[model samples]
Structure formats: structure tokens, C-alpha cells
Target chain A: MTEEARRSPERAKRLPRAVREKQILDAAVQVFSRHGYHSASMDEVSEVAGVSKPMIYSYLGAKEDLFIHCIRREANRLLAAVEAGIKPDLAPDMQLWHGLRSFYAFVAEYRESWTVLHRQAMSVGGPFADEVNAMRERAIELVAALVVSAGARRGLAEQAESSGEGMAAALVGAAESLADWWLDHSDVPDGVLASWLMNLVWLGFNDLVEGAVWKPAE
Target chain B: MTEEARRSPERAKRLPRAVREKQILDAAVQVFSRHGYHSASMDEVSEVAGVSKPMIYSYLGAKEDLFIHCIRREANRLLAAVEAGIKPDLAPDMQLWHGLRSFYAFVAEYRESWTVLHRQAMSVGGPFADEVNAMRERAIELVAALVVSAGARRGLAEQAESSGEGMAAALVGAAESLADWWLDHSDVPDGVLASWLMNLVWLGFNDLVEGAVWKPAE
Candidate 1:
């Protein structure tokens, strides 16, 4: 056998199942992001991953299952990155600022992941859309908790509790929509995007908590 | 011939093509909203519209074409409602407030249309998703114009021009997202939902134009 052929088995043996699955998933995400779910192929994923088709199928099942895995993995990674970026010790606005910054940073660094998670998965629809929705619900809950806590600190816990989730849903949607917009307008850096959102959302949220409402000038 | 059958031709003649198409479209929207695109049947649409299947085919084409027509018609109606609600004589904030109130009112009045336009079309993906995106682009442009004008009135045209479209994208997204959230939390009145969004976004936007900014605590 050739030298590379002889080393292949050894490499496979050294890499555990989890490592191989990650390799397959990484390749799958790249391919899916580039071509989307309908047009993406298993062959490209295998070639990019340097794993055989059978091996990928064994690790992650077929293309549908593989796409799901990529979505779930990327969604978790995004949430984790934002969560890690938040400093609970800081004030609510500061915590949100950091979270937004981390979110944009993650999107900027992993454009492919964001593309697959936000664009590809959403357009593919069906169960894929469901997965993205579930992830969004989690993100909303996280923001709602922050809004409620901030309200409690201001002695407006009842008002905050009543409107916090809806407000969080709007904020999450704004962040998501801005990120999707950034996919086309990449010239704007991540920090600026995050800052723009902060100026657009946090200031208003601050006013709401501070009992300053904007009424129509009828 | 039976008395009813004798007058059928006269009735068909009296009802113009446009009216017939509207009847067919209304039924199609209801069916699509209830059963979704794939699971929905033309038979149900015909039954609901009181129009024969062959007549529907002649007027609106097959299931796919009929669905597209439904989406386009509803999108136009929605845009028209919001546009009509805005009074150019009013200030920008009041204009937007009126526009949002009109939007929620439309959603409340035609929950089925909103369901088909927002949830069903999006989940069906492909061309349907493209149609929704096009509608969204038009909305963003409308909001961007409002932002740019508001900025110009404040002598901050340059700042607004640079970020008007992006900010509008975020605002439009927040509105859409909140509407979706309102779908589940229907206890909140249409006025309350619109006011919540105004408090969540308009105040922040107002602050931005007035030269207020939120910065990191650090």
C-alpha cells in the first residue's frame, strides 16, 4: 500500500467518533451555506470533510439530518457566544451592549454559520424553520429575563413583567433583521452595527423603564 | 330548467370578472391559511368560494398560481391600508404611529391574510419566500424615506442618509416580529401592540435623530 494509505487507518483510529462528526458537520455547514439545502450535495460535503460518503452518513445520517445538525450546532454556538459575552454584574444596558457586540462579532467571524442559520435554514422551511423558531424563542426568553430584571431594579417590575417578553421579541427580531441586512452590507464593521442597534433600542428601552413614554401629539 | 338554474347565467354576467376573482382569492387565502400551501386543496377553495374548480382555474390558474395571486393581493391590500393611514400633514412620529395602528388593525381584521402572508408563505419557502421578501423590501424603502425626511427636517440629513435604510430594516423587522408575537399573545389589543412597538423603537429612533447616543459603560 502507498504511504498515505497506510497512515489513513491510523488517523481514523486516533480521531474519536465525536471528532469525526465535527469534521463532517463543519464540512456540511460550509457546503450548505454556499449552496443551500436543496442544491447542496453529500459528495461535496464528503470531499470537503475528507471523509467518505458512507462515513458522513454514518456519523450524521442523510442530507436532511446533516442540515439539522448544522443548524442546531450553529444556533447553540451563537447563543453560547452571546451568553458568554454578557456580564451579569454590569447594569442592564451594559450587559445588553456586550451581548449585542458579541452577537455581531460572532456573525462577522462566522458569516457562513450565520448564513446557514439565518438565511438557508429559514428559506428551506418545514422542520428547519421550526428549529430556527425554537432557537429564537430561547433568545427571546434570555432578553426578556434581562428586561424584567432591569425593570425590577427600577421598581417597575409589574409593568416590565407584563410587557417584557413582547419587547424582547421585538428586540430579537430587530437584531436578527439587522444581521441579515449586514450580510449584504458587510462594509459596516461589527462594532458599528452593534452600536447602531444599541442606539436604536437600548435608549428607548431605558426610557420605558424610566417612565418616559412617547404619546401621540393628537 | 329549474328557477335557480335559469338565472345562473344572468348572475354570472352581472358579477364582473374582478368581483369573481376577489371571491376566489378570499377563499384561497382562507384555505391556505388553514391548511397551509401543500396540504390545502383547490376543492376546498372552490367549496368556500362557491365557484367551480374549472372557473377558478380559468380565472386564477392552478393551485400554485392561485396562491401567488392571493399573496400579491393581500400584500397590496396591507400596503394600501398602511399608506392610507399616514397623513403627510402630521409629524413623522405621528405618521408612523398611525401607520402601525393601521397595520395592527389590518392584522386583527384579516388574521387569515396575515397568517397566509407571514407564516404559511414563509414556511413554504421557494418562490413564496421571494414574494414575501419583495414586499418587505418595499416596506423598508417606505420607512427609510420617512427616516431620511425626519433627519432632513432636523438638519441631520447626512447622518440619517448613511443609516436610514439599515435602521429602517431593523424597525420593519421589529414590527413584523412583534406582529408574529402578537399572533400568539392576542390578549393585547391592536392599539396596545402598536403602542408597545412605538415605545420600543420610535423613542430610541427619536433619541438618535436628536443627537443622543448610548455608549458602553467602560
Candidate 2:
């Protein structure tokens, strides 16, 4: 073996367990995002991580366990990114706008992470799907809090209390659906995507809080 | 055995294939909705439909095939219901309002079918998920046409043409997410649910057509 190649394994062996685990996870996410769960291989993950397969197994169990870890890690990262993007001091609309911008930015920067957490984990179904769903619920709850607070600000606490969670659910779904659409239509910038949603949802919500409602003429 | 008990199989035999198929699908949807695809049993479906297991197998192939059939039937029924609800003579807002009402109505009337087509089918993943996704795409396209036409009415055809599909995807996602939320919070009637969405989306869409937009303050 070449000197560097021979020493690379030795160098990997000296890394701390947590650092090695991160390396494995980073590689696993990449592999899973590319091949999906069913089609992804441990060998490729091993080769990509520059860590031995046995080391990966010891660190993260088997393929299924490894895939789940990738999902949970990526999901946490996404939620944290969005949460961090929201400046609590801002108006609710600005808070939501910043949140959406952070979300799309994350999706844009870590395309593979988004793919693994969203498309791959979901298609694999079972526990993997449950993980994604749980993350989605958290996101909805986060937005619901914002919606309720905004309504309370407008002296419509009762109305917002009743519908805030539901509206948040719809908004979260729209964001997710739009993100999926963006995967195919990547020509659209992330800022533009966030703006489109803001135009669609924030203005609509602004009207609701202002007591302007749409009624059928008939 | 009683005469009716003894002759039931022969009576089932005498029924037309289409009628029998409907019976099986109805029962399958009910069972699948309750137990989901994997946990659902052919025995339960046969018992519910009053058809023998052998007949179910012969008609629908197997559990996988049966689930696909259920998804297809329910999807078609849902799309037809929404399309039929829309009157081309009405304005775009009215048309969308009618469409959402019809969709929620269908969910209310055929809760089992919707449960199977959306929750059960999606969680099953693989080919079942594909069927549900195909239905969603068709639904998006249907809404996109309406959005584009609405923009045309406002003389903003170019902007509408550019963003119509993405907006439609978001709208469909919102409708679906709200429907899921409604499944848990059903005290709100379907009409109210439709109106909630109308307030959330239509008003915002109206603002877009009117050239009013939300901008972030630096």
C-alpha cells in the first residue's frame, strides 16, 4: 500500500468515538441520499467515510439503524436551523419570513441532507416515515405558536386559539410541498421560493387578523 | 344450515363482476383504513364483503393489488367529486371555493376511502406511495390550470404562468395537511374547513393578483 493509504486507516483508528461516528453519519447520509435506503450499500458508506465497516457497525449498528441515525440527525439540524433563523423580537410576519428563508437555505446548502431526511426516509416508510412525521409535527407546533401569538396581538385570541394550529398545519404542508416542487425546479432561487410562500400565506394571514374575510357572492 | 346460509355463495356467484368488485373494494377500503395495509387481512375484507377469500384473490390478485385498486378507485372518486363541484361559469375564486368544499365533503362522506388512499397508502410506501403521489400530481395540475386562468382574468398571465404550478403544489399540500389535521379535529364541519382554507389561501392569492406584496423590513 502507498504510505499515506496505509497510514490513513491508522489515523482513522486514533479518532474519538464521537468524531468517528460523525464521519460515518456524514458518509451514510450521502450514500442514503444517493441510492435511497433499499438500494444503498454499507460498502459504499464504508469506502466513503474512510472508516472500516466493522467500526461503523460498532458505532451505529447495521444499515437500518444507520439510516435512522442519518434521518434523526438531519431532521434535528433542519429544525434547529429554522428555529435559529427566527428572531423572536421581530414581528410575526418577519419571523415567519426569516424562518422560511432559513429553511430553504438549509435545503439549498445541504441538498443531500434534505433528500435523506425527506425523500429517502419517507419512501422507505415504517419507522423511518414516523421519524419524518414526528419532525413535521414539531415544525407545525413551532409555527402554530407563532400564529397564535400573532392573533393574540390583534385581539383575536379566541379565533386564533381555535384555528392557529390548523392554519400552521396547512402552512407547514405548503412549505414542504413547495420544497418538494423546488427539488425538481431548482432554477428558482431559495429566496424566491421563500418570497412566493410569504406572498401566498403571510398576506392571507394578515387579512384574517385584520378581520377582512372572503365571502361567496352567491 | 339455513337455506340463505347454504345458498349465499351461489347468490354471490350470480352477482355481476362489477358489482362484486365494488363490494370487495368497499370492504377492502374499510378494512384497510382501519388496520392499514400491512395489518389488514383478506379474511376481514372477505367477511365484510360477504365474498369468499378465494373470490377476493381471484378478483383483486392479492393484498398489494387490492390496496392499489382501493387507492385508484378512491383517487378517481375524489378527483371526480372536486371537478364536478366546480362550475366553469363561476369566477376562479368561486370555482376554487367549490372545489375545496367538494374535496372536504368527499373526505367527510368517504372518510374510510380517504383514510385508505392517503394515510394507509402513503405509509405503505413503494408502489402504493407511487399511486398516491401520481394522484397528487394530477390534482396539482388540475389546480394549476385554475390558478393560471385566474391570473389571466387579472391580466397577470405571465406571472401566473410562471408560478401557477408551484402555487398549485403548495395549495394542494395545504389542503392535504389541513385535511389530516381535520381527521383529528373533526368537530369543525367540512364547510368550515373549506372556508378556513379559503381565508388562508384565496385572500392571499387575491393580493398577489392585485400587486400587493409582503416585503421584509431591513
Assess candidate 1 and give its lDDT: 0.92
lDDT of 1 at B91: 92
Q: What lDDT tens digits, residue by residue, belong to model 1 across residues B106-211?
A: 9999999999999998998888888988999999999999999999988999999988888998998998999999999999999998999999888998999999
DockQ of each: 0.85, 0.82
Itemize residue pairs with steric clashes in candidate 2: none
Candidate 2, TM-score of its B chain: 0.95
Candidate 2 off by > 4 Å? A1-8, A11-13, B1-8, B11-13
- Compared with the true structure, what per-residue lDDT tens digits does model 2 show for residues A60-134? 999999998999999999999999999999999999999999999999999999998878877778899999999
Docking category of candidate 2 = high
Candidate 2 chain A least-lDDT 10 residues: A4-13
